[model samples]
Target: MPQSLFSRMVLILLGGLILVQSISVVFHLRERDRLLFRSNSMESAQRIADTLRLLNSLPPADRHKFVAALNSPTLRISLVTPPSSQPRQSPDGANQAASFGMMLRDLLGENPPIAVTVSEMEWPARQHEVNAPYRAESIHPRQKTAFTVETHLQDGTTVSLDALPTGQAFPLPPRLLLNLLILLAAVIVLSLLAVRLATRPLNTLASAAEKLGNDINSPPLLETGPTEVRRAAHAFNTMQSRLASYIQERTRILAAMSHDLKTPITRLRLRAELLEDDELRVKFAKDLEEMESMVAATLDFMRGVDNPEPLQPMDIMALLESLQADAAEIGHEVRLQGIAAQPYPCKPTALKRCLSNLIDNAIKYGKSATVIVNDDDKQLQIHILDHGQGIPEAELERVFEPFYRLENSRSRDTGGTGLGLGIARNIAQMHGGELVLKNKAGGGLEVILTLPKPITSGSMATKTGAASNIQAKKPRM
Candidate 1:
């Protein structure tokens, strides 16, 4: 999954999503804490300012009695004897304390001089050195502190407002964090699905191209997906159509020409029969017969190469033995060795015809051939070893060209149209395999027909092209 383009894209997108989500979570929590804490501070400032206003409204004698009335669990207003020079800041060292002080001053008005000091009860003025080590961000919304306000009244009595839990602090809500996590997961899953959808067409197109190489008749790619994908598919289909048409047309022309030539050669043979000169008549008839046979063989070769056979499952062992028996019957020395151990899907007739051609070449030249099949998971290697005087290394590939016999090495009678190897190679390639030629270690030629196993669901093309090794003298034909 990770190797696929779609999977890689999904992983990349998921990484970015995770990074963005992490950043969002951090920012959201920090912002939530800030907003909540600021709100708590403003509330604290309001309560303090209201207490001071009530004290100012009360007469000096009534201030002490009203002080107890203003006292609550969150706030305490007491009459201190005298004002102090310094007051403690809140234990929570956040700037909210200063902000609260400014807000309080704004509400109280400038006409009366009001001094506000919010100090941490946990770390009091004289105990700053001792409790400073414990100063940390409070998890709670309520600030834990002592708010002591000391200012002289007109009668010299100091009124103080002390609030407990004076610090302002807030943490992100658990519910909000949970919702963010759920949303992140949902988006990530959806992103993966979208990436898969986008890349699916590319995989299909690639698979179709591979199939097309093995079988030009492979089904056309489905011309549907995004607009860009559809356009590419349409072009691919058009190319396939042109290629298929071109191959069929060429095969048809070869067949037509062969048929037309044979008719003329047949008429010539009849005319030769009516000749009075026996020797000349015999020569003309012989030439005409050769011409007719050559045309027929050439037509057969073309048909074999361009066969439109579909792949079918067949046992390699059975095919090899069958070919061996056929060759032996014809006085050809063909030996069989090692089984394929399993059946593989292929164009049975094409593969059989290909093997027959190679074996025939081996018997014709080397006088004997050895067929050996060896296979692994990915490919089947069928080696045909011949003991003939192998062609020179430079001319090995040239021998497989149609009508390209080495007259010096190959007798005209035996090298039938010189299209056997060429046709065999075409058949092998149609099955997605290849033909390879190599000189045997000792003497003669070794032909390796490397056929691919089914890639997954169906037969693959075989090697694009073998001959055997034997120590026997050439056939006395």
Candidate 2:
């Protein structure tokens, strides 16, 4: 489901590790409980055996004293007449007493007569009867398991043992939780490092691709990393080389054509100069000049889009205001509404040229233009708004095509070689940006020139590091 390869890999690895750890923890805890239960059961039986041996060795007169000394909260020991060998089952059906009876017979040798019975601590039927020679106390009422053991000795004496030893409850292992946390931390750190390493080449490809859009001559990809990544890089590098070659070849052809056409254009201008008729001669010169200007503009646009100037930090606010001031001098109404928060790395000359063209269009078609600069986390936006009739919706996209414009703005009267908006759009796209036009809400046209932020080595830049004249938003009237 994840779009990123790195995220997918991390999810698979972390999910499997957590599941395996969960199963192992569950299994180990259960095994630990079982072992604890078995060991506690063995110890309870041994206690009864050890006390029986000590009691049998003492005389009848000292038996009660020894029994009293051996009695405990869990294990109640005393002497009494041997209970019948008849079976008395417990309420919970726990056969611990039966199991221990067999153990006692083996531990005390075959000659000893031993019998055992287990019952719930709250045995409703009856309690064990102790002989007058016995000195014993009742088992703790809280005790859950009430077991009684009877045995006959060689001297014809009998003794009884009541044990209610509970198995140890499962312990909460803070140590285990601590261990899991440490392991999880180590895994996360390792996963992050591994993901970064795996995704590094893809990141390189992405950066190279982005730069390729701005500069067709972006440097070749590194072609390093895993086998798959290396193959992808190789293909990418090959593609970049082919594209740059193709664009370069096309540019070369256009330049040569423009060069060849210049000679004829100059010859015609010279011939027009020698003509005698004033009206005819002047028209010939005008036609020749217009032809030369169109050729020059076309070639200039080709060069601007494919071969952009080098990037440098520029005060875009000052640049816009300068344009506004220049237009005002020519009696064209241009207003600088807002300014950028910082200077950014850009081809200032190309951008200025692009802005000039857009502002010219806005003023010529829309009567007046206002330039507003706004920037956010990712890109810079410059809006050129005009107060005249907006372009028709159907022709908004067509207006950007070279030599193609709206019927209103494309007339010879407008005096463009039909390359102004096309050239401006190309310049913007060459900087990894877009120039989009839309009709404004209040009855005018708005052209938005969106420029991408400069990509830095470690990360994409969000703020300008160098100081410029404009640090805060201020409008210069």
Candidate 3:
């Protein structure tokens, strides 16, 4: 039921330890009961047989005095007249009596007639007197075992002994539970340490995997610890190497192809310029220009995949202001809102290109673009919204595919290569961020760019020590 491996392992180990402890306690109690009962029965039977033999050897007048000598705290000896009939006993009491009587007969032979009866009795609570007839050590606390043994001697004198001995039930060792608790606590501590050590490698591997997504050039995992964990780390490092090599090779090939195609495109453009019919010349120039644009866009897309830009902390507001000024110069309206609390870690050029493409799309399809920034310790979000007809629901995700576009948006009149959204998304992913599109309620499209902040050693300290501005900035109209 536990979600974490550490918690699950501790629960299983603790459960098994408790179960084994319970079984051991039960078995110990049973064994203690058997040993105590045997010793107590044997001692009681031997004392009674010896008392009867001593009375028979002495004269009747002196027998009573000697009986007082045989008395003890556990056993009381006295003289009694023989009973007319045997006393009735419950089945369990009768069985105990029979067993005790047989033990007496085996010790004393058949000469003396002996009768034994066992009955359960409770000790009075008020017997706390220090000088009572029986010592506190000789009496049981709650239920006590009461037994009466009678023997008829050779001269018809009857001797009776009543025993209310202690140790009828084995007293529990006072430190049993305390010792078990201590053992359990120690074992639990050891189990936690072992489980944490065992799961540490898994945590490292997961962190390495996440880091790998952010930067293909990130360092490989260290191959240490157990054999299985070492093997997994080695495999992950190998896979990362292969992926990086493949991307580099693909980028080199695309770069060569783009270079090879540019020469032909230049020649075609020059030849078209020398044509006699102006209309035919314009059409040929347009076709050649479109082809050249497609080839350049494809190369850009490929380069975005394997961009080698390093991350650095940069002012987000300054970048947005630069973009706003550029759009203003081009006669396209762009508004900026909100403030970043701190410099965000990012590949500056790649992130700028990503935002530029998104803002351009908004300006092209929608009338104008408004960029809103929301920043925190965990992540930075920039939302670019527009004021034109929004994309259809079915084509929202499909528009991100390379060279794919809506019927109205990707026409030749619009002068687009249809790879802008794909290139933007690729750049966002390379920075360990995401770009998402959604239709706004008031009519237009909204592009959300989410960039996660990298966690560094001093980040937490800085966050705790620095004062943050929570008030939002108003958008420029």
Candidate 4:
């Protein structure tokens, strides 16, 4: 299934938006987590430090009251002083000062009045060692109080502080992920709605274009959408109105000219009947014939000015075969080659006339014609070959102008009204096809007709038939 431009545009816009939003959400969550963890950790560490400072300010007799007030199953605190003469090694056979120095630096000032140390242990062991190895000594300047505080909290956690605080493990909240999922779903739904809203006007414009081609008098499209879309719709409506007016003016002018010519042509035909000299009469008749041909061609051209032929599925091969057969019956050496067995959707009658004109011209000048059809998936091409005197490169395009014959002489004996090629080109263009004339390699003219492949039901049916035929004709034992 082929998608229209509007549909493709909508899908692309929504897809790009979704991708950007997803990336933004991920980055946002990561940043939020970083900020949240940093704030939480800072707050927890500050609360612990403040409590220790308050405990230190108390009088010696009121110290027990301070500790009792601070007592909680979720938190514990213990104090340590410097070792006297002999220092007891920590249970892990490591110097406590070295192990706790880094944590002390982090919690307190990097250089404190009293040096501090900190360590970590499991809840049970941390409680058991709270009061062991109590010692007193002076390690700080001017008899400052130096203390070691150990705290055991619920959930099998302990914090041993000589100076600084150790960081805790923190995990992202599950609710954050759930919220992100909800945001993503909402963004997808909203994006789809936005795409639909943006493309609605484009869809209306497409339908209006089809209707306008079918009938110029069709109502203008409703313009409702964003600013850009409304402006575009307005411009399209204005262009259509101008085109209709131009076509009407041209039609009126052609009608008046055609009406005026009829009387003069009729009088001339009547006057020719009474001529005495047969030679003179024949010349007059020839002149009348040329005039009649010109008038008919002009009328056909004028009629096609506004009203183009309707499109339909046409079997190009069958059309070409019929043309070849007709030309052959008239003793013209015409051949058909490389014809596609499939039917293409086009204006059959208009295409038939266009081909006939080319073939007729070939037979007239070269006395032979060849018609070939070739189809690739992209396009359908029809080539008409002739052995006629090829046109000069400069004059190739000029030949398609009405009444612009290559031959300088205006004599009817040359057998051309100079309108055949012009009419053929007009018919081709009406069907969204092009007629191109080029010099053949072997000194003849080649006319190429190129048209877009059609995507209609009738054309599809024809393609199906062609496929079936090819399958049946496949080589077998």
> Would you estimate the TM-scores of all the predictions?
0.64, 0.71, 0.78, 0.60
Candidate 2 local lDDT, 1-477, one digit each (tens): 798898898888888878888898899887786566456666677787788777768788988887777665567776766546745575434445555666666666564766677765642221344322232353224436566777765587777777764556667789988998998889878887888898888787888888788788767887676889989999998998888888888889989999999898888888888999999999998787777777877876777757746766776777777777778888999888666766766776677778888898888878899888897667889999998888888888887877775556557655667788888888888888999999998999999999977655124223433322333321110
What ordering of candidates by TM-score runs from best to worst?
A: 3, 2, 1, 4
Distance (Å) between predicted and true CA of 187, model 3?
1.6
Question: Which candidate order results from sorting by lDDT in descending order?
Answer: 3, 2, 1, 4
Model 4 residue 284 CA deviation (Å) reads 2.1
Q: What lDDT would candidate 2 get against the real structure?
A: 0.74
Residue 355, model 1: lDDT of 83
lDDT of each: 0.72, 0.74, 0.78, 0.63
Q: Which consecutive 10 residues in model 4 have the weakest lDDT in total?
A: 468-477
Residue 385 displacement in candidate 3 (angstroms):
0.9
Quote the lDDT for 102 in model 4.
Answer: 38
Q: Which candidate would rank higher by lDDT, 1 or 2?
A: 2
Better by lDDT, candidate 4 or 1: 1
How many residue pairs clash in each candidate at the backbone level?
A: 31, 0, 0, 7
lDDT of 2 at 149: 74
Candidate 4 per-residue C-alpha lDDT over 1-92 given as tens digits, one digit per residue, 9 for 90 to 100: 22766567657766787789789879987777555544444543554566655655665567567666664322345443334343344553
Q: What is the per-residue lDDT of model 1 for residues 1-477, given as tens digits with 9 covering 90 to 100?
A: 589798789889998988988898789777776677566666667777778777777888788788866655566677865444665454554365555567777777753555556565543222234223332342223335554555555455666666554454545578877998899889988998899788888888888897787677878888876789989999999999998898788778977888788788878888988999999999998677667656766665666545677666676777777778777777887888887655677777667778878888888788899988898888888999999888888988997787787766575766466777887787777778889888987998899999888766234323321111112221111
